[model samples]
Target: MLAVAATWSRLAAMEFDHVIIGGGSAGCVLAARLSEDPHVSVCLIEAGGGGDDIFIRAPALIPAMISGRPRINNYAFLTTPQPGLNGRRGFQPRGRALGGSSAINAMLYVRGHPRDYDEWADLGAEGWSWADVRPWFLQLEGNGRGGDDWHGGGGPVQISDQSAPRRISRAFVEACAEAQIPRNDDFNGPEQAGAGLFQVKQFRQGQRKGERCSAAAAYLFPALGRANLTVLTRTRAERVLIEAGRAAGVLVRRNGRRRKIAARGEVILSGGAFNSPQMLLLSGIGPEDELAAHGIAPVHVLPGVGQNLQDHLNYTILHRSRRRDVVGLNPRGLVRLGRAAGKWRKTGEGLFATPYAEAGAFVHSRPGLDRPDLQLHFVIGIEDDHMRRLHLADGYSCHVCALRPQSRGSVGLVSRNPADPPRIDPAFLSHPEDLATLMRGARIMERVLGAQALAPWRGGRLYPHDGSDAALAADIRARADSIYHPVGTCRMGRDEMAVVDPQLRVRGLQGLRVVDASVMPRVIGGNTGAPAMMIGERAAAMIAGAGGDGGAKAIP
Candidate 1:
């Protein structure tokens, strides 16, 4: 373990078998798995503090950590103004600590529909079909419900049902069922089109039960006792050093001093959707024209280095609740919260253990669709503008997002300096089809909230709309933004636009690969945290030449 504030006069030059940039969700998995052989050395570098604080471990403090005002453990990056969003800039809050976004997220453990991976294989991502990748997902999960054909038990990543979901959350699920959406106990099972409580990436048993089990807590921290692994926090990678057409090392800066760390084997970038592509462009491995425009000498000309950006654009519907059980800023709610905190500390179960977005549903926006095209999240409290805005009255919110959008965007350089944030443009709702689907979804959600199952709790709709297409379309354009699932900037495929190959290796480059959500051929139907870790697990096997098809064996 190392800190940036420590003196590094004696650590001028260091070498490792593998040098991984961005100590995030996937990077933690890579560092832990690759260093298990004992003979191999791994170095993991992160630009944030260690992710073991109470703000991250406690499940209910999500709003505090996700706030942009103080920027707790979040990057809180703002996207470029989207013409599709009435020219309003969207908020993109990414985690900046060891566990990455998983540490600050709502901890929903979603695997997406199986066909999502099948689509990846269809898009020239060979050896990544549903059947081929199922083992990897099973191998990474430690489900509290025990192992079944669809889930795994005793794995590194802990998953559990919400300890004590709020009453309004249950009411929302019931309302979904009343609206004709079937009740599903497990979204990762045979069927995905239904409503139920979402399983979270949290400890299910033992002393840490109900706590957030981020990738760093599940993998990296457990492997820290290994002598061959070195974890460096608050260290930023400026660029990758390419010598003789091969990735040789990374130049990093810590505490204002720059150092060169050589990689004897490989250099992996796991900086999520935005930073991974930005790193490639900074290393002069992107388009020739973009490089020249930035005053950078192009080393590799991969035109797709930062293209194909996709995300789930979400619009939330809120209602003031007549019931006091839902979370709120009112006096009665605050008193309940104080008592719940004490109970949580004593028993690891209470209101403080809530993940907030406790219940959700997957449903098709219209008739005749084979699978669900819209996903919904039920929040226990009123949330607007990513929770940046607060409400004093007791209320609840339901978030609806199109499962797969057709719009494409890109991540580009603002300057050659690595310190500058990437220029992000999700280009949300640019396609007419996306807007159509969201309109249908919004109508469906309104019906569900109006169902008799939620009549006891429903108070007043926060954002009311006249029943008309134009009103709904205008509301969508004004309020819709990202649900924080951004992917496909450094897309993986065999096409000319693919940034990385099927094996996750950078096209036309050696000893370098991208193993994060950025390499996703398309964004999945749900959250990106679990899929990102699965990518790391599969990539480790491929890099180590272990399983022939990159299938991970269950860890005993």
Candidate 2:
């Protein structure tokens, strides 16, 4: 390892006001926001190349981006065999590009339930309540719905309605209504209950048409010309350099060369939950025993560095359909896709403009719950095993997840090498209550699919093999997996085990902070991308000394 003095000398010629590790969703936002000051120099380092492929820009190619082996833009990590999942190893596909998962995700723009943020406040993350964080959400969103108390009209991120929603998609929402679930025009509105179509991160009203608005597109690319900001792609951060109890710099590797980048103001880790905690542990900031086992000397024995891992585990229910227009793997669907592509090239308004899971719902497992515990994603295509398998028949699938899982897992170091993937253990369904909730959700979804509103599309049940709750439970244990949302590894709180404090600063360190999904005290009740970007916005305000922190000094 390079000594602090040596590292400082090497980077003396090019020190930055803020060195942000990981040019993912949070890092891009931070780099964009902080460089706006003009006086503060910002550096953003990304492990993957600039995510600018045509496939990345198209909203309909999400399956191709996320469903496969590790590629140039994907970090396909496999979890340790999950006991809760019947010894099945879960496949996790995190974006390895500049925009992170935002570049590859389905582009749903959900803010999650307001109660999620309020619960963060209750769990020692003061000033993170729905009331406190709502403004930040508005500040980051350029919602096509126009500026309202619930949304903003002019911001970096574009929130728009689906361009060419399928008739089957509308039927799913109507089916939910037939099953007694109310129709919600806006999931981010006053309440989160009910079923509706999801708004996405695509261009709503522009010549750009149906292009995706990822974090890089929304925040990073527009700010590229700013002299104060420097973004380095395909550079992997190896460790955080701490000297005399303060974060001084970062050790990184690019093009097979190791170098240190000094941060004059602060070193912020914007890596997502999996990577952020792994970086901490690799840099000797985790549990003493774990570090010693890896032959790493502990710098800060924060046992909570990789603990409290939580993710939304979901199971999908597939049904066959007789409709020929519906997308599938058959020759007719391929021909339709080709025609859609051609139409997209000209009009940008066709079947190619929509994301796969076009509609969704949030409902309770039982009556009188404070909030909905179950979430649904209605896909217009059959997405079995993350679309790794292409079903020949035209069909649709419904993904149901227990919004807030009770099981807690961890991400740990497999080796000292930064290039090696971290050990992930989401421990899906370890908690009995989680399984019960999922079973209830599956039952509720069955009713919705069976509703008369879907008679035109529904053919026959093709999943779980049987409807018995016992068989469903067994199938869940066998087939349940992540919906791609993982958080809470480096949870923010005031407890002794909390990795970061309410201000998002590492509790036992100075001049260092974590501003990503890892700092969530608990995973939000909806998709995590929007919440992750919201955290980035909030972090920028705190760093610029212009936001609330519940009395904690946010900046060094």
Candidate 3:
């Protein structure tokens, strides 16, 4: 053990041109793109094992990783008790491996409404307008449907149509259409307000077709053989080593030993919403009062380091399924799943390739809305409380979430300990407007589920409630939680409260940047995985262009 520790300590002394703190969605992209130059050395540090497990690759096995029992590749962190949720602490499951949440998410490839980015530009995030960021989205997408005005043909992340969607999923889309929501085959196309099956982040062709196309699979693994890139897994970054007010390196722990990994060019934090802001606070680069309270000497005073936390608060309307084809914990369902697993092993086309929330829609909760304020995810299983609470009967669920929530929460330090989980407070539905919008969305979903298209499969409504506004409001408060899209904790803007500039460089500090969903000024209207990757693509361009010496450098 001493010899092994000595070898690791010596390897840690080696400096790299760029050292990324989190090997997540954006970190994988950054490592791949930055190392493309071949002259610059890049090191990616991940706190979990390599994300190449069979459970991660198989889309249908998502529950195995997400379920916190065995805690496969999931961080499975829980948020502080939310007042809006009747003081119930919501479950916050983030991927702990190289691909990050993208490795364990439902695999939906949603790019959000264009106006989400336009709003960011309007809010002082310069160069982040819809027109400016669209190209980056296109550049990173490899859609199986081929490139058009809104998509790219060949890129790192593969996007494909669901290989074999369940019949119930199709019925859900039809029911949405029957309830007056128009059918939209392509949600990522010109309009996002409609119902249809979702395109997933999965391989569409080749031997790995139908497998989850996580960031590690699409970007990092392909670049692993590059001489300039080094990936260190199960390595925890303790704090950023700031020297003379410029970020110099990171103090990390591996195998219970501490070592400093020098960053000759820049240090990037892509630790998603929770960990990214935690990293800033741990380094004494956040609110002065918070840092002082934790007994950590202040390195930089950025009051907005962990503020403006936002997430999509979702409420579900569940119904027991009359048919046996849907996913459940019954004997018949398990037998079917066993057979499906066998088929998946032979050919990557079966129930095993399913991204459970197969079909969904985006619709306005009321008239006069410019864009879809509500998003619905039609799950083919009975997902009660992030699938932690299981039911014996087969059922289906429809999740209704307010896309642009007005509520804002925060992430804060517990004791300046990197090992300790940060206090996460998404404060879902804290705003009166958010609650009202979600209530309206729930009514809409109830109607869609009642439509004739789903009647054949829909059984008695689970947790049946009287059709009253007051009853619906109570249900929402009691059961609402996040759909796993957390963002904006380390928001980027030119305002005083901004942690990073529009170029993603941490304000009031040099040689440090944040390139993850946490830097979003506002959470988008859809899943955050694709947008997080886009941020990485845009940051790589900014770093390459700003580097006058042909190596990565902090932009002034």
**RMSD of every prediction:** 3.3, 3.9, 2.6
The alpha-carbon lDDT assigned to residue 189 of candidate 3 equals: 97
Q: How close is every model to the real structure, measured as TM-score?
A: 0.97, 0.96, 0.97
Q: Lowest summed-lDDT stretch of 10 residues in model 3?
A: 1-10
Q: Write the per-residue lDDT of candidate 2 for residues 1-556, one digit (tens) a residue.
A: 1010112223435579899998788888998998999998998888887877777887777778677643747898889999999899998889988889998999999999999999999999988999999999999999988999999999889999887899998999999999999999899999899999999988766666788888988998888887777777778899999988888999988778888889888899999989999999999999988899899999988989899999999999998887765778888888898889889878777888878899999999998989999999999888888777678888999999999999999999999999999999998888899999999999999899999988988776675465677798888887889999999999988888899887889987788899999999888999999999989999998988888542233322
How many residue pairs clash per model?
Answer: 0, 0, 0
**Which residue ranges in model 1 land beyond 4 Å of their true spot?**
1-13, 548-556
Report the lDDT tens digits of candidate 1 across residue range 389-502. Answer: 888999899999998899999999999999999999999988889999898899999989999988988898887889799988999899999999999999999988998887
RMSD of 2: 3.9
lDDT of all predictions: 0.89, 0.87, 0.89
* Candidate 3 lDDT, 81-172, residue by residue in tens: 88988899999889998899998999999999999999999999989989999999999999999998999988889999998999999999
What does candidate 1 score in Cα RMSD to the true structure? 3.3
Q: Clashing residue pairs in candidate 3, if any?
A: none
Which pairs clash (backbone N, Cα, C closer than 3 Å) in model 2? none
